[model samples]
Target: MRDSEMTTCAPTLLELQWAVRRDVLGLADGAASEYVVPDGLAPQARLAIYRNTANSTLLTALRLTYPAVQALVGSEFFEGATRRFIGQCPPLSAHLDSYGGSFPDFLAQMPEAASLAYLTDTARLEWVVNQVLHAPDGKPLDLRRLEQLADADIETVRFLPSPAARVLESCFPVDVIWHAVLSRDDSALAGINLDADPVWLYVHRGTSGVAVDRITEEQCRFTAALLAGRPLHDALVDGPDAGTSVWLAHLLASGCFVDVCLSSQASRRATGRQVA
Candidate 1:
């Protein structure tokens, strides 16, 4: 073949794949033109199958990640919403399960979803649950080891959520709504007054598997601060209502922190005190 013909025939694999992806995601109109089809072969129809399959896969993944949202909005509405969502926010990574990390934010921006203001928070809850389920396993922080430290040492150290732990705060009753929908308890759903108080949630892997607990606002604040890599002392400053001794005991018992970060000097001090 001539040089020009060779060039025309040999589009890079990446270029073709990107064109197909754009078409599947509805970002472009003429992806099928990238391919040469023989007589009697309908390229548009062939591409449509791939597009439909992509949409179906995305819908299934979304439903799995946000089952509560799907149940709350009903199948038809959820499907329609997801169709739009996938178009606007196509998967950035090949990992399908991690695809909808921004789905809650996307739902928040939708006009139809606005009436159900809690929907976004619900999505957030589901996403967190999904993430916690997949997080790595680790030994929780040892409470006994923590107790040997002095108050000043404790203050200077930072706490980390166990690989299993995730904290989320919502202005809506996200935990209640999630449980009600999943359990198919209509009465429970009915009793949830939308005007009711906001909620703080701690989703983590428990002894029995994944568990979601409703924690206090102070606990949520403290947890958020810790997750942001703040020292325990600084984290406690935001919420005076979070009693230091009480929460320390509760969090330690809850197995929330997988590891504690004590400075090199503090670690030596703690070790020496233990030896003494």
Candidate 2:
């Protein structure tokens, strides 16, 4: 068929499918072979190189983000595990930072990694650390503004947490596992129970790099509620039964909540009048 006639006939669905497969999966076929320039190498060899390069680049990114997890699994084992992971779950975003969010869940199900039961939780902790480091920064809420509200109005005061704050919970002693891998300090690992109930962790950026700390259940619930835009009184109500005053004071001191908003329409109207 003439070139013009072929074009007018409309490209076959098979031709379109091949193009998409080549672009997305880096697949090699007769159509794709036409574009490749073989330099003293077989076409299959060249295509194999492309496959290796693609897998290696993604593996390197996962390694950088989860160095502690890599160390725990050893280089060879980690590479094999990551290869399986990448095959099952290719990156979903252009940003590599968000690439490994599902790695913990992936590790949890891998039978080969079953011996290191804590590995999955460790991966989760590392992912959370990365997320907290990249979270946005914001100013601490003004305590003086909080004081201006009447006792009845206090319950209507909604909280906004700093974008940098993150919470992580794990059944394994993930904090201990993280420190052990990163710091080469085993002291934190002592007395760690892999089967214990999940421990809650909070991470935030302070003056230095990201600071990670264990948090009480009450604090976890309170901060989680606040992060979800809950009002102060409602947050406390949802939190564990403890001293509300002390928990609020600690949250303020930690610079966790960034701002307060009016949860009630009445408060909004009152504040609008004051602004006017």
Candidate 3:
């Protein structure tokens, strides 16, 4: 077994560490006094200091990832929810950015946020933006090379989506909510119609930085298939429900695709990248 996977701490020390974790999360305590060394502070007091630091650190991480969600629901409320969320789903990754992906789901299930149906979707959108912002830059596909492909070869071409590309669909107009909350437009937030058709959106890194786009359902379907590494012919097999060429141009122009390869050569190609 890998050293990390093996028990490195002595039994008592490991038990105390686990106890400290439970204490930090406000879970059942493991009699910290027995494990901790005698110091100026009592064991529980020392544990309390750690608890404060842990909660504060995790809270900061959540705020950074879900700023819009925090803005929508006031900071006080957000902090309370985050505390409960931490108790339930503690940090799993050393990187804080990877820690709160499940926070949207946690909020969705919260009784306090039950009235705000759009809250979950808004948080989900924020998570996507956070992810895209942190993802590695991808080499944009050369459209000229695509033009060089013969008609038969074009159909068999498989496009690789940018690493930062993501799609989201929500019954609520989450894009509007995101913009309004981030911009602190109380008027826009107040004017939102909760009962609207689902909006399909894509989050991707643009020429400038992370950006979101409002796309049609047909466009969503087409782009989703391509994002899953489907070939051109298969991605269009069903219905675009709109002009194929137009949607294709829009997605390509939007930096959704990063590289291209022949469907026959996909398995043979070891990596998703294409070298110049």
Candidate 4:
């Protein structure tokens, strides 16, 4: 049958789904025109209702994920920006919570958000906060086991950060801004100097909930290297002025890592052995 003939006949389920999806997204003009409606109901009008509902629900999720951004830009302006964001980045998964992973990058590229350099970084912090909150719980690495390792074994072993741990490095004082917003203290927000130096942050679940801590450059480098799967010896760069013991103690105390494993090469190097 011809394309026009198929439309005249009953629409297939797949065709109907595509039409509804396009209408919800405000795409083609006549994607939904062929649909059958009751006498009182208008297809375009009904689709408009659905379009509004879909956009509203997705926008709500975006707002929740980036509340700080919404607050920085006023509610009305944020809503308008969010509508634009939704049009460009639609939901891919059934779960709304999994959405907006690219929103930070989207804000960075948005023309309106261009003036606010810190906006993208703030969005990133918010996303990491959400990720930490949803991450599964796990026990911290055991200190006793770490202490028992021989010096050679220590260098050959690797450290892994907990599933919930994340690092955010920003040229702006995003941590301070996020804290100020959380505290709801206008004075604190005013006192924060945006011209401050760059910041390295360690975000993870603490005794309470998600905890954000400002870390030193040295700590950032070491933790980042460890997280990248580098063995401890390779990761231990001599920059942090802080002694190795102090850095190690702080890392263990923070509970950033959940497990430790010896690299296979560690054994081979120990006994002058080689694997075939």
In order, what lDDT does every prediction score? 0.83, 0.77, 0.85, 0.82
For all predicted structures, in order, the TM-scores are 0.83, 0.77, 0.83, 0.80
> Which candidate, 2 or 4, would have the higher TM-score against the true structure?
4
**Candidate 4 residue lDDT tens string, 1-276:** 356877678778998888888778766675786574635777778788889999989999988888888888889978988888888888776688788889889888889889999989999999999888878887999888788888879767887678788888999999989888877879988998889999999888888888888988778777787776678877765444557658677778878888877888545555575443
Model 4 lDDT, residue 172, Cα: 93
Model 4 misplacement above 4 A: 1-19, 27-40, 143-153, 238-241, 263-276
Query: Per-residue lDDT for 135-189 in model 3, tens only?
Result: 8888778898798888989778999888889999999999999998889999998
* C-alpha lDDT (0 to 100) for residue 244 of candidate 3: 76
Rank candidates by lDDT, best first: 3, 1, 4, 2
Q: In terms of lDDT, which candidate is strongest? A: 3
- Looking at candidate 1, what is the lDDT of residue 104? 93
Q: Write the per-residue lDDT of candidate 2 for residues 42-122, one digit (tens) a residue.
A: 655666676677678889989988999998889999999888888778776558778888988999999999889889888
- What would you estimate as the lDDT of candidate 1? 0.83
In model 1, where do residues sit more than 4 Å from their true spots?
1-4, 7-9, 36-40, 142-153, 240-242, 262-276
User: Stretches of candidate 3 above 4 Å error?
Assistant: 1-28, 31-35, 144-153, 240-242, 264-276
Candidate 1 lDDT by residue in tens digits, 127-185: 99999887778788876767777777867787766777889988888889999999999
